[model samples]
Target: MWQNEPPVAGDLPAEQGIPTLITWNHGGNVVAVEGSWDSWTSRKMLQRSGKDHSILLVLPSGIYHYKFIVDGVQRYIPSRSSFCS
Candidate 1:
């Protein structure tokens, strides 16, 4: 599940700005959200949930590109439009 909006009442604090929660349910040992936010160099490690991995990011209002890195492998979600080069 990929949420670009902040949750009403949940684990994320309301004062932490807009929260974008990215989650992945897989058997990998590690997962991350890598994109232009970090120059596509570093990986923001996601926290482990019950049977999934997730990460909460506070981002400004705008559009951004990103992909998931699971166990050192990069995977991109297919977009309807040509957003990726």
Candidate 2:
């Protein structure tokens, strides 16, 4: 599950942020996530979970944009009217 919202009754204090589970279901030899959290600088690695790849991120409450790097290819979920970059 790719959750963009901050969890309620979080594991950590509100100031410290909460652990959010991010999962990538697309198949790839390598999978990672980059987002506004680090201005896309840090490519956090995701471990394989059955057929999906996932990672736990501790993020503060806010809106964030993210993309997946699958086997070195940057991918985004396209909207119905837009094409994938």
Candidate 3:
């Protein structure tokens, strides 16, 4: 799990065995997650994306089309300009 001990590296799951989000946004006193998974995401994260905002749904699955999400939103490519750049 951990390379050493004490404080963990960031908020990311060391194992990543259980799909989840590692980061969140702090706005208006609410801790908003960056990504959403499952059906609960609409009730949490997506609603905050702003009506003027449009998310690019990229499901680059290899086969069977199985993609994991956070809160309920699809996982994004951090290297892509549409996401982070």
Candidate 4:
């Protein structure tokens, strides 16, 4: 949820999956290597939390990707030009 924040406590259900789940970072900032973040506290907590349940806050590598067409040719334009001003 946040980079420099503590776990949020609430009455959430761990049913089907981890009690409390957090998707990508608040701003989709990939923090670490592939599975390298596996050692982080969030992963650890997911491990210790219980069985049939898990939690992980992975830091994915940053990337700028998008599908577009340029010069009459199809292209995978990852740049911000697609959303230009």
TM-score of each: 0.63, 0.71, 0.19, 0.18
User: Candidate 1's residue-wise lDDT over 9-29, tens digit each?
Assistant: 776655634577767775577
Backbone clash tally (model 3): 8
Rank candidates, lDDT, best first. 2, 1, 3, 4
Model 4 stretches with alpha carbons more than 4 Å out: 1-35, 38-43, 47-50, 62-85
Worst 10 residues of 3 by lDDT: 59-68
Best by lDDT: 2
Least accurate 10 contiguous residues by lDDT in model 1: 76-85
Better of 2 and 4 by lDDT: 2
Considering summed lDDT, which 10 consecutive residues are worst modelled in model 2? Answer: 76-85
Each model's total of backbone clashes:
0, 0, 8, 0
Better of 2 and 3 by lDDT: 2
**Per-residue lDDT value at 82 in model 1:** 16
Misplaced by over 4 Å in model 3 are 1-21, 25-28, 34-36, 39-85
Q: What digit string (tens of lDDT, one per residue) describes model 3 on residues 1-74? A: 65765665776565433322223222222222333233334423323343222233332222211122444445
What TM-score would candidate 4 get against the native? 0.18
Q: What CA RMSD would you report for each candidate?
A: 11.7, 11.0, 12.4, 17.7
